[model samples]
Target chain A: MDKFNVGKHISGKFNEELEAVRNKVLAMGGLVEKQLADALSAIENSDVELAERVLSSDYKINQLELEIDEQCTRIIAKRQPTASDLRLVLAIIKTISDLERIGDEAERLAHVAKASFNKDQEHLLVSLENLGQQVLMMLREVLDAFARMDEEAALQVHQMDTNADRQYEALTRQLMTYMMEDSRSIPKIMDVMWSARSLERIGDRCQNISEYIIYFVRGKDVRHISREAMEDTVRGAKS
Target chain B: MDKFNVGKHISGKFNEELEAVRNKVLAMGGLVEKQLADALSAIENSDVELAERVLSSDYKINQLELEIDEQCTRIIAKRQPTASDLRLVLAIIKTISDLERIGDEAERLAHVAKASFNKDQEHLLVSLENLGQQVLMMLREVLDAFARMDEEAALQVHQMDTNADRQYEALTRQLMTYMMEDSRSIPKIMDVMWSARSLERIGDRCQNISEYIIYFVRGKDVRHISREAMEDTVRGAKS
Candidate 1:
């Protein structure tokens, strides 16, 4: 999408190495996305079996992360690819790290599902599942954006985090009100609040992955920048 | 400390580049450590001014992270460091990312301090500040281990996360009890819970840094490993 071309490398093998590493990252992303979906499913239906599956599946995502990390280090040492190629490698490194952490958050969310909530707390679980679904959608879209290295799509995903945060804040306020109204349910509501917090964090991780995609495509570090500034960087680049 | 001799690189310029990047990371670590200290101080005393300062100081840590990240990327592009040298660069990259997130948690702690707590809620903040100090010590130790790439010390710091987690759980349960006992304090207690969660996360980030130190020295991916396995990796490596 940018000026640098991975396809035109002098060594076709080197191009393959980069492609292979990126593919591994995408594969890891796919597994993590599934884990999030499963975690949300478990939470929604209070499926302890599904939640256990998500927990054990986390080990696989961690394995994929380490495997891909080694491959990236090997490519860097072997190919010594410069410019956008190196940026791509660095972005993959960072993207996988975020993906692994998303898997951790998913595990935590799954734990919330395992907790036996009373009948009165069912509505709180429903609210958490609502937010969980929103975060799941964001994760799916960000992974899609990363797959295409689409700067425009990445920017859109980044902006969507604002809505996710709003949902999370609303849930937190609702949980607090629920606790105040029925103090005996405070312990259960607290667990739901933590789950809501984990969902919010998953949104932030997706936003981080989106930034990495933009960094790879645009050769600019868009992190720590204002939303308007990030938009300008992503939109103003010459294609 | 390991098999690599960074000081004896044939290209003294490359040696300088590597050394310079490592020093920048230490400097950034120093800044983040200070931010954590100030945030804790603000929380203990309810010093809004100091809390604001910690919040502002977060920008500096973020800027330093960006600067150090660019330096690492430039080193890789220019030096093409291989083997241990490349691992050092990678470790530096990953360490700074964790450091930056630690800064974010410190900013979150600062916000907790800025909130006006009721006089009755003071003891909860005291417990939070207790856990805050424990995490602060862990951060300090991890930074020291990272500075030396001391695998032994890193292992020690990594083990400390268990204590931090215990403290966090204890604080969480205590807060829940307080919320149940006095439902009127639910909102304020929830903020304290968030702060305690931040402290626990800071502890995890420190554990990550400790793992990075061991990886830099031992050339192993110790993440997601058992405590015993990580110990074997860190302690069994040849120096």
Candidate 2:
């Protein structure tokens, strides 16, 4: 008749299971991050083989995501985790999804690199490279927070997303100008613009992942709220 | 100690609670559909007041999302529902987030409409109206699928997204052609391009929502997969 005793038994096992799921997600995060780096390098050097490798590796990311998701499903089915544990599983499920999409974006960038390198689009290419670096930095910070459970680090990633978005907008404007001044540049510039848009989206996805961390550890929805409000809420809880 | 008896007692209450959450999500879905319609009308008329109203109403969408998410959280915390019930709650939570973002994109379209109209870019206004109509159609279809739980309807939305993207590409190319012909039209065409991008994004968001329906009712992950694959998978499952 004692609910507390029943809770203790389930909670202990649930935490261990959820932690396992978290570790899998972090591992998937590392794979996606490396994939992004490879994608950039592939684009930078016009490494066709490297680009092909990046494309092939996406399947692995997909398979791993499915596995991790199945594991989370099994955990929820077998063990009725609550509060933080439930949030952790849910967050990981969503985070790996974002991570997998990053892989897709990276593959798209590699595709552009394969097709458009010989074209006269050096400036747009440089812009893409810059955008890629910024997104990678944001993604890395969020993963670090997830791995270490560092709320401050996670919040930093969320803030960086705003800056990334601004950069995308500026680059979009710049690309428009390039295409406007030279009709011949339209096709190449469009390629660069789409790639830039993809990187900005990667930044947004990273921000979504950071939100999941806040939700998991702090149990708050920080999606539409301001960064200052999010930081205050998370920090308030920590203190 | 029979656990089935305990589960039965808990699940009986859990079903009622989950139904309430589902009802809330459906209601919110209806509200978002209305917002999307208002946003399109704002874009067509370049009505700043309507834009402001759309932005203001975003708060209500946000509030509804938070309420539904909190209800799901409470159910999750209390009953610790598993399997189908857990999937339903999780899906509802995610769908609400996507719907909230759809509203944000609509608001964005309205804001840009305000800016473009303020600049007196009458040349590009017709295209904005057309793009708004295209996006509104997509939004209507997505909402219909979600309300009806129709997988085929959802699958159609994804296909429609590709067409929207192609139209956006064509719009961008047309804008580039206009800008290149006369630098005087550059500012006005830029506004057109943003509206086109926003409309394209609305279609993308609708695709995202349709995918959520597929994931929730069908228990499949269709995020990175191709549109054809998604539709085929859904069709195959239903058959």
Candidate 3:
């Protein structure tokens, strides 16, 4: 998978600026991936210190987003990129927004980890851990797809998200059953439920990032289209 | 209160296109507002029919988002708008995404309305209704601020969202207590809790839209900045 080239613009300076923006976006993506992974580990181990660190580190992700956004704005204002060049900047802007949001969701999960529960409820943590792993994988794959401009890899992320959604739904049902069996566990279970919700949202955001990748690579608005239709379109493009 | 002008590009066709995109976004905002209102009413009254209408109408919001996004992309490609004009289009593109997500949150609330509960549960409904109304007002004001490019109004929305957040936190605590008192009511209470969460998210999205409005009006990225810092910056700009 060859990374999409951005230095094709006539002006060498413009090309250099665009490449800088791309590199910054990838850096930001790396930070968000680390945030998600650390947050998930904090949840699994109930490591309050690590959870606090994840929460504190969200500022860095937010800072990176603002910096990348400013660069995109500057590129558009200075270079006035058109066609594919314009789309590349636009996609980076949108992707960074999603990445920042994923960081926020990770912060939310970290807060859940920071919460104190009376008993060590390993059972409830299992489903959340599973959902977290699935979303983390989706995030990693989508970022890779974005870096390589691989529409096929992006399409695969869409499929992964559907499985994440199923896992989330199952976890919710399981939590509900837990609450019903022992009312005392309701508060602690609710924390896990919120964390699970955040994980599901991260999956949705990852899918959105993949859609942006597809749109950037193929110049197609696959959004609002049915999954089957989107997959078919991707297949058609491949052929 | 003057709307941000976009026709300065020396191309009348570009101005017309920009106006058309703005109109489409406002139309989409109108639909989203209606969805939120209807979903709230359905939740308050347990009106399944109204809830279903809100659910069905979400497709239109999604479609409008896709249309607005495509138009933004086309405008960038054809006009190569610079500086403020470029920022305007980028802001609209981002605003529509937030609008679409608000519609999603409304759809989730509507589903909660559609789910049959054993009892009226008016007690839990009150806080949700309050949060919903606060978010609704914020959404309306933020859209108006965007349409008029009113920095002051957008700032007011930021304040409104703070109140919405407090309401949401209170509601969640109350619902947790309800679940503890009567384990039998846990499932039904969870529905309201989820709906409240959706409202809280809507408030967050509205806040994001307001941030975009500020960005477009002031050409400053207020996002990720602390509220005090953002306010100080806005004041400095005014002075």
Please list the C-alpha lDDT of all candidates, in the order they appear.
0.89, 0.77, 0.86
Of candidates 2 and 1, the better by DockQ: 1
How do the candidates rank by DockQ, highest first? 1, 3, 2
Instruction: Please report the candidate that would top lDDT against the real structure.
Output: 1
| Residue pairs in clash, model 2 | none
Better of 1 and 2 by lDDT: 1
| Candidate number of the best TM-score | 1
Model 2 residue A161 CA deviation in Å: 3.0
- Model 2: how far residue A42 lies from native, Å: 2.7
How far out, in Å, is residue A171 in model 3?
A: 0.9
lDDT of candidate 3 over A1-239, digit per residue (tens): 23445444578888788778888999999999999999999878889999999999999999999998998888887787776777888889999999999999999888888887655576677668788889999999999988888889999998898899999999998898899888888888998999988999999998999898888887888888898888887888566
Tell me the lDDT of model 3 at A94.
92
- DockQ-based class of model 3: medium
Candidate 3 overall lDDT versus native: 0.86
Please give, for residues A102-122, the per-residue lDDT of candidate 2 as tens digits: 888988887877765555666
- How far off is residue A215 in model 2, in Å? 2.1
DockQ, in order, for the candidates? Answer: 0.89, 0.40, 0.79
Q: Which wins on lDDT, candidate 2 or candidate 3?
A: 3
What value does the TM-score of chain B take for model 3? 0.96
Per-residue C-alpha lDDT of model 1 across residues B37-69, encoded as one tens digit per residue? 999899899999999999888888889889989
- TM-score of chain A, predicted model 2, versus the true chain A, to 2 decimals: 0.90
